[model samples]
Target: MLPEEGVNAVRVVVGLLVRGEYEELETLTEARRLTAAEIAAAVARHGRDLISPPDAAFREVDAVAVPHEPADEHAFHVEFPLWTAQDGLSDLTLGLTVTEVMDGVWTVELDGVHTA
Candidate 1:
């Protein structure tokens, strides 16, 4: 798959999580800081359903961009730029995880996040 496709897959995963956790994210303020480390911890405590691949682990990363190599296949890498109005948050990159659970059925998970 093209790198663009991979990025899209990642975006889908992120969208689901955000939509699912919109209420909590919206309540975030400077007083209510939601650091990447904190979020990563939450993913560990409350399953984020972020990823599941052959040998993939359950962990979260703080990132703003999940870089994808230009020459990649089977493992598609795509990027989705996120913008936020909340203070101290300008962007969030959700790493996309695509898996072939069944024939033609694909699963997605936001496994990586860019903080830098």
Candidate 2:
């Protein structure tokens, strides 16, 4: 099972893709290992009429916002922009941070922690 925080982030990204918002889905440096952009693109590309442009159609994401999670192991978190010209969906700015809380663990252990 995936960590709830990671799962929630994946869900939100997948939800955004399902809604046809595949523009400017940049991957943060920290999350390079997760291949978030590739995953998002794959999820976004799953449907017909969903075009993966040669280049991102939206503005460049300045940063990624990572939601709070446990204080152990490693994790990837995202930040969405405040507002965007794209309708229906929220602005897609912000940043993503991949953290390594502890060494040697392949994934974070969020069993005992609460996410906010």
TM-score of each: 0.37, 0.29
Error of 1 at 100 (Å): 4.2
| Candidate 1 per-residue lDDT over residues 1-116, each given as its tens digit | 33334333444445544554533332421213344455556444533344322111122222233243332314333344333334223344444445433444444434445532
Specify the highest-lDDT model's number: 1
So what's the TM-score on candidate 2?
A: 0.29
lDDT of 2 by residue, 1-116 (tens): 23444543433443444454434223322333334455455434323222222223233322333444574445554443322233323423223343454553332211110111
Candidate 2 off by > 4 Å: 27-116
Score candidate 1 by TM-score against the native: 0.37
Evaluate residue 102 in candidate 2 and report its C-alpha lDDT on the 0 to 100 scale: 51
Per-residue error (Å), model 2, residue 93: 25
